[model samples]
Target chain A: MSDAASAPAVRAAIGDSEFDRDTALVPRGPGVHDIDLSAGWTIMNAVNGGYLLAVIGRALGQTLPHADPFTISAHYLTASRPGPAVVRTETVRTGRTLSTGQASLVQYDDDGTEVERIRVLASYGDLDALPDDVRTTAEPPAMPPLEQCVGAEDGPAPGSVSSPIADRLRLRLDPSTLGWAVGAPSGRGEMRAWFALADGRDADPLSLLLAVDALPPTAFEIGLSGWVPTVEMTVHVRRRPAPGPLRVSITTRNLAGGFLEEDAEVWDSDDRLVAQSRQLARVRLG
Target chain B: MSDAASAPAVRAAIGDSEFDRDTALVPRGPGVHDIDLSAGWTIMNAVNGGYLLAVIGRALGQTLPHADPFTISAHYLTASRPGPAVVRTETVRTGRTLSTGQASLVQYDDDGTEVERIRVLASYGDLDALPDDVRTTAEPPAMPPLEQCVGAEDGPAPGSVSSPIADRLRLRLDPSTLGWAVGAPSGRGEMRAWFALADGRDADPLSLLLAVDALPPTAFEIGLSGWVPTVEMTVHVRRRPAPGPLRVSITTRNLAGGFLEEDAEVWDSDDRLVAQSRQLARVRLG
Candidate 1:
């Protein structure tokens, strides 16, 4: 955390590291924060969806009494062009244990009028009161255990692990699923990988946002790639994370109309479901 | 439509058809609407998630310049109790082709202080500008045509179809998938059906909200039932529907912490995908 002396310098170092700096919402009037968009948080030129949602989630946490974000939903009103954006939060509903509110990322136009980029609604609560009587008939996909997976350092895989986000969040792809990325494009849309912060910070509610949206668009496996911009996304934090990498999987059974919906689930190393998200995105067409 | 001469009288005639009535937002103070929740709109005693979202979506339509709701994201902040509620809309981003805003449902507490029930972020646009160059590999689940299906009119099976929402929305379930509701348990979490308005009114964006959530909770197939309140939900409109009933399929591959996420897709009678939604819900446990 940077102090008042080097706050400007911290803001200058944009990208994955700036994510920590950008989401830092202090107690100001109406929960204010100067959003920072640094490297790897971008696909082509626009800011990544998960990165924007994470910033909004952090701000919503500071604005509400309950801090652990149980759920967050975001609508991309327009293409969120990064750089010097203003985030503002408002209380929608302050409930007993959960509080809901809306946060907006706005930037100024050449004429100096504020233009909103993205809007989000988030719910916050503490872990002490998480639901207890949990049960599931369908289990998440079984991985080959952590020891058998390959991380970014493994290098030269079927598909290139190159992106602004891959630097901050290292991904370990299950070797079996790489045929679509590097070899012949598989007709099916699916991707499974293990994700962890490069700095070794344990995954948290904020980091889970990145983990969910950080994967290459599932449409890529079906042979379509080029900046999938999210139109809307919703994330549910099922449980807090343990001290380990997150096992993540994304699947898109339907890709149509220059659009596709991707469903993602994130499980901690403990094998507990940590977060689940689904998003609608427009596939960039030639 | 009821006239101002008998607004109170109409509010008393609750159920599926009133869905259209309850969500009719007039431009009062900041696009105002006195939410009317009649019977069946409630599960057990609490209001249903889809009912609340439909009401808010209607209000959002009145509040924005682009009237079509292309996408809506709602986070249930608190259990919405029945009775008269207030819904207000505020602009988040006013874009050229699309506009985003936040709408909230609130009620007064016993002490007369206003409390929030559900908060939503909605995006509105015109259907004339819908995506054209859309392509998807996955077609909606093949149905045996409408006549071959069974509707609630067929009467009692194993599980009771008697709910507050049953009267407003009529669902035609595929017979093979009903084992969990009756006879032996299916032991899986999934549900597929065709949905239409009970009143025979053409389904609109607001009505589609009802169609998505009106299904018997997928958890019921796995031996879990009762009130399943949605925690967070996101809906994306792919295209405007043609004149016909909607074909819907819901699947839940994970359930934990008294919470399960349901993914739903709606295809219009024209066999074109109209809308897709996913929501996290808490299954009521004894």
Candidate 2:
């Protein structure tokens, strides 16, 4: 992963970045695509849910006749690992303002028996076609200037973090919310941060899919840790994001019965709501 | 719709209620089922988003080789009218703890053309097989006793309420939050009520689905009215309900740029959190 200063060069090699490279779906024929998985997307022993979903989204975007992903949702049925997988797509609906479809990623065993892992449903639409009557009173979160925000340069030692996917994205966390880094979690289940590709690629709909779930689990602030597996996640892309870093904030209302919902809002630099996402995850007992 | 005085017969007909009857998908052939639409499920010329989704969900539940629905998500592609429609489902993934599938609802035009209207992605699981480490601190909202709650018996005159769907749902609306029933709105976009099938049927996943969207749009309380069409919705079932009324509450956080989100939580009479839902909808600008 590249630091902010060398991000452009890294961006140039985005085609080689584990993220961009692994998610690159090659169209083999109609309704089908070939994919290559990488360990860089793994957290612990399982593939990162968001990373796997981005691959599915990229495949749907490439295989289907759509310009941009308006909403991409995935239900994690089982764990996926690094290696060769196939994505199969089927048209659900095609409309003037939106196109809908479904895609699945599955890994084949030694005998070529495929086991399904991720199931995704996507809606594609022209961002420009959105109604201009946008109305919301949501103000941007209180964030320190980019310079004052803390990036990976100040994070835990190289071997300390649990997720390797973190190395792929550059996160400038809102300082006040970084207490978890020091082992003093707020115990409040909330997080605010500025995120962009470590390779400096401009944010896009696919990247927003990653950004939505790439952040550390807000449950960690509630002093709960260890694999917080997402059962399902749905994202709504409301506006086209302007090129720049994205500001995101997540809040967990209640962590009840080992199941919790995390709601996040993604805002562009101009304070426009670009996307909104909510995920249901099963938390590991403390 | 019957009142509490004749609740048993109402409950008896629940298995044959309009919502239940319309969503009782009958398998006509492989990956396809016949569904009948009813005006009882409509608010205007358009069918209720939640009602349409339950039909889709039930279809998936029946067509998919799975048990209970854990996650049911749908993105509305077009407005649907009450009539004959068919649901077509395709298997996405079949796993141990979870099974995933996709289904679509479509109606034929008078010209013999088929148009897709609703697209749904569902994750199924065996609730009994879930982990027993259930622990949550979520408490039911402060609601007065059942006797003190005001049922629809006291609502606006028959011709006043905008949504006819309310007549089919027995809602004991918390009176303090009913300003919108009059010209004076609460202006806070929030509501808490005791909800049940107007026919006195016990709550189920389908009813919960309807309940999520069946309420008068919270936007109305915020001084916004007219047809507030839901763009997409995701429902997460936390647990099965115990018999009796469900205490539920919904809140809208922001109404920005022609779009808004509503989050709702349903708690069984025993105060167990049963389901949680979040929906994104286009607002009717005043």
Candidate 3:
């Protein structure tokens, strides 16, 4: 992992280790900290969706004893409880080359009322070891490298917190990111941009997954609209790319009513498919 | 719901109460039940794939409050844990017209060591009470309706438990479902079939949803190989068809190696797209 001033910090708060005492902010743990539903980002009053994805990534990394290179391919579904919840995980099977684990997120009131629950299917194993034919033939579009990709002179306007929780997360758009991206030469239409995260968390598989999901606003083709929090996100991790130089790709599959299902492919500088995610976001135009 | 005479008598030895528990089973609370871990018709130690779908169906039903003219759709993302485990659901949102719920499932040893976990996304609400273009235009296929669809002669061998679970749950099937169904009308391809499930119990929305998932035997295309079960199911409920006479339509989207993904649509005799589902079944063909 490269450490540059522009790199995102990837550790849980110091002494803030109360939630996942058993696991590191990055990975390797029997358990992870229980995020306080009441604290943290407020989107929907449910735990911040970004944080939830981070935890899921951490749990997945820990469970996959051998899954060094993998990416989430698709998200078939999403379910969450409104609350501060604690997530726990169990490894279903761990093979020399393949493994499966399930993670359960439980939302509890201060009274332990058990408000919500979530389960995640984490698949881990060796991808490169698989036959060449199984590998994805789709290559990243050739474009000006990150250095050549320019950032928008004016970044996200000020006071743009559409959701109270998003506001609480202190999310900011960095202008330098525009130059940090390049779309495929094929004119796939989808844009790829790399942005700096506010917290600058290390790009662990989980954090990386979350950060990748947070596509820079510039990726959207249409003009600004209110941001709808993700109801649920399913990410398939294909392989781990270099820590920094996060590559974000965005595309929309089905859009209807006030809801849309979007997909993003996050890559490393090497252009290896790091993770793929599907999100159902409630959209609102400014 | 009416009970057919030929309904499997497997429930007899287990006694009337717990034996017939699959239909009326409710969540112990707001958590997932690792029902697949339990044993029965399929195998001794390995989980019976169909039972997992039944458990999920039951959980989805209880997550929503009682209402008339409601529907649900779900897709199975992965197969279930190999052994006995039951998942319970927690209601995420319970509104007068709409409700959302989440559940987690885990496997455990007889000593209570947890193993696998899964999460579910379910929504229930009353239909607009009026038909719209969104309604299903695909009229119920001309195949013989439910009762007349039975194939005592052409169906699974006299005592072949290998028959698709849908065949067993349904009172009968059209000639299309005779014996074991394989592939679509093109016959060159995917497995497809349609059937009807009786309101063996209350025939409520949840019950119907469970039936919808439990109906399709994606792993059994050629027929149940090992213990293929459902890990997670995502459902979408569009509209309701009349109660009693249930219509089930199934299509396999893709199948490769030992893994397969399927898309299923459930309709009522009236031809309403009651629910839609996708399932991932792990095949361990014997």
On residues B1-286, what C-alpha lDDT tens digit does candidate 3 reach at each position?
Answer: 2344233333332213332454344345545433434333233343344345446546665556734213222223334445456676666566554465544556666788764444444444455542343312234445554445554334453344553333335444444543344432232112333443322322334444554554435444444434555433444445544644565666543333344444455666565556555454445534
Order of candidate numbers by DockQ, starting with the best: 1, 2, 3
Question: Backbone clashes in each candidate structure, one number apiece?
Answer: 14, 6, 73
- Stronger candidate by lDDT (2 vs 3): 2
Model 1 segments more than 4 A misplaced? A1-22, A34-37, A43-45, A78-83, A108-112, A131-134, A142-164, A174-183, B1-19, B38-40, B43-45, B78-84, B108-113, B142-150, B157-164, B177-184
The top-ranked prediction according to TM-score is 2
Could you give candidate 2's per-residue lDDT for residues B201-231 as a string of tens digits?
7777767787777777788788876888877
1 or 2, greater by TM-score: 2
User: Chain A structural similarity (TM-score) per candidate?
Assistant: 0.86, 0.91, 0.63
Residue A16 alpha-carbon offset, candidate 3, angstroms: 20
lDDT, candidate 3, A148-197, per-residue tens? 55433223334333444332222222223333222212212244566443
Q: RMSD in Å for candidate 1, one decimal?
A: 6.9
Which segments of model 2 are wrong by more than 4 Å?
A1-22, A63-66, A142-150, A155-159, A162-164, A174-184, B1-22, B29-31, B63-66, B131-151, B155-164, B175-177, B284-286
State what share of the real interface contacts each candidate retains: 0.73, 0.47, 0.00
lDDT tens digits by residue: candidate 1, B126-242: 866755755565588766666566676676566575666666665778765677656565877878887766665656677788778888788777777677878788888777777
TM-score of each: 0.83, 0.87, 0.53
Supply the DockQ value of model 2.
0.45
